[model samples]
Target: MRLTAEQIASFHEDGFLVLQDWFTPDEVDLLRTETYHEFGNDQPGRILEKNGAVRTVFAAHKSNDVFSRLTRLQKMAEPAAQLLGDEVYVHQFKINAKLGLDGDQWEWHQDYLYWLKEDAMPTPNVLSAVVFLNTVDDFNGPLLLIPGSQKMGTIDLDVEKKYQQLDVAESWKPTLTADLKYKISKRTLIRALENSRIVAAKGTPGFVVFFHGNTLHASAGNLSPVDRLSVFISYNTVANALQPIANPRPTFISERDFTPIAALPDDALLAPRNGHSSPQREQLASLAG
Candidate 1:
């Protein structure tokens, strides 16, 4: 769906926008099924927890048809293009399955920091579309965003202690171990946002949240009984593709494809089963099959 002028303004001001029921129930169900059935630990970019539960599955769009289409939908891509002010391409695709107890904490940091430091992304011309496959609420460990932080530019290293770009380029790799602390000083983050109220990224199934690439955000470990599943699709402007680097990450982490995204029809995911002639019949079929 096309974004409203007000929505765009809000995003620029707050660094994020939440869309309720962006996808229909049938669509959410179809995608949720794919999340559990289509992913496995054998993949190159998969990261598991200490208990061996899948924490993040990267590059699902490249392998799964449903996800491949979902990421390119005009509902998401169109708005991303408007925000980036250029044609967009997929930079990263991942699914986070924060299982009941295995859902680990993701430290406070901006996504642009990761893309800039490790992935060799030149500018902050990227954004992420987060879709809730399962309900996200306070107890389930919703993502937290510090509003208006994107306007501060990239929050990072001290000038004197800065890593030489060449030295950092040759040696550093993206690792989740202390990932949150690595991007920014956790203690410093606490002090900077001491006056700001945190926004919990909670929503129902089919709900979507879009945040700027440089938005300061984090998620807590799941302590609730039920699991939380969220789909994150990142879009980078084709002109802002990865820059030359001394060492590069796997293609799954930083996609090599710079093709402009083409969106499917709005109803593509909610389309009926073949041979279903009536709307009622289609509705029942979606629920049954």
Candidate 2:
């Protein structure tokens, strides 16, 4: 799972690295099955697209074994650690299901922007590892990444008034606040980066992409008949965890844990689910009984 020096260099230069077939077809089948299982449940942290399709199911690691292990996958975790030069932890995990036509556009933004402003992250030592769970093509709203955008570092955005996601007290402070909510992409910066190439990555299931935290990226609304399913595991260096900040998003959006992740074996994700139940599975069985 170690990236070659050249590959690492490429990631630093271009702000992203795409690995084709990082997961086998079999592995993707299992994970995709679990993804759909999550989509079936209606719960908090499962956010909806503006058109009402599920945008993301956050924190699946807490409730699913397959996803839990994925957060610590060596292939994924090692890259983050190597780039950040420190041990890392999961900052956030999400299953993004962009259903056809109903899928909404994700405004252009950088991951570290949210981490720095909302979580008080001190450095851009965080990165996102995305596993495409279904076929992704240009028409299906593939992620658009601005090449070398991370080199410019964090951008100061003109943030709008924080929209309340909950009905609770506006003045009362929570761990997460409205002011730190995600802002729309700044148009001036977009115009500035217009010269940079925008890479629209299209790949089949199991392809993985690792991107810098400050990479400017976004996706168009899914207008085709196909769904674009993907999973994102954000890794933050332990040394660069977070300082105390104002009201933050819920735990699902920005996890509070700072424990360093211990990478599981390369074969850890290959275990068959049918032969033996995972700890979470056992719990589920007991609950059903």
Candidate 3:
């Protein structure tokens, strides 16, 4: 579960590292099933696209058994701790879905922007553990990331003008939508593109990509007939937890707990159902019952 020195160096250079088949197919099937179960709930955390398709479901780890175990899996937690060089806690957990033909485009932006502005996060000592729940290809919307873009640090933007209509109290919602409030301007993107190339994250259901928090990323609308679903678990260094904002976002969006996450056993997710083998087995049995 630990990352190699070469993989760590590559992540530092490119701001991302992809591990194909990081999870087994059986584990992926379990994750996909749990994702759909959470998606059917009528909760404020379930964001929808303009076309009425499910967009993103936030904080499922709090309510779903499978996702809760996923956050603590050794394979998922160890690398994040190694990369950040500190004990980490889950800052945000969500399932981002691109439904076939109905999914919308996400504009170019860094994931850290929302944390910087809304949560008052001090530094970018964070990373996202993205697990592919479905097969991703060119036809289906795949995440696009610029190589080494995280070294640019925080890109400046005029927030007042971009979100002039909404007050500061109400601006956090728009920033999470398709039309993001903190979008990277075309001129800035063009300049960055001059030095960096776009990488399409294409892989199968078990693929996992761990990207730096400040990495510039986005995705196109799904054009194919298949849906693309991915889990994004934002892991932040426990030392650099939020500093408190006046109008903080909901718990689902910005987790309030600063407790460092303890990694469960490697087989926590797919442990045998014979019982007494995994700490997660009791929860899974409860859900199944």
Predicted model with the maximum TM-score: 3
Q: Model 1, range 183-240, lDDT digits (tens) per residue?
A: 5676767765876668998878989999999888888889998989999999999999
Q: Output the number of the lDDT-best candidate.
A: 3
Candidate 2 local lDDT, 1-289, one digit each (tens): 8899998999999899999999988889888989999998898878765556787788999889899878777788888788777999989999988888877777677889877766788999789999998889989899999889898888866444444454443422222221234654467457647778779988888999999999888888788998888999998988887887667667777888898987776666765565576875454445323
lDDT of 3 by residue, 175-277 (tens): 7789887879888788778888999999889999999999999999999989898999999999999997787988899998999887777677876543455
Q: Weakest 10 consecutive residues, lDDT, candidate 2?
A: 171-180
Residue 195 local lDDT, model 3: 86
| RMSD from true fold, candidate 1 | 5.6
Q: What residue pairs clash in candidate 2, if any at all?
A: 175-248, 176-247, 176-248, 177-247, 177-248
Q: TM-score order of candidates, best first?
A: 3, 2, 1
Clash pairs, candidate 3, are: none
How many pairs of residues collide in each model? 0, 5, 0
Poorest 10 consecutive residues by lDDT, candidate 3:
280-289
Off by over 4 Å in 3: 160-162, 167-169, 272-289
Instruction: Write the number of the candidate with greater TM-score, choosing between 2 and 3.
Output: 3
Give me the overall lDDT of model 2: 0.79
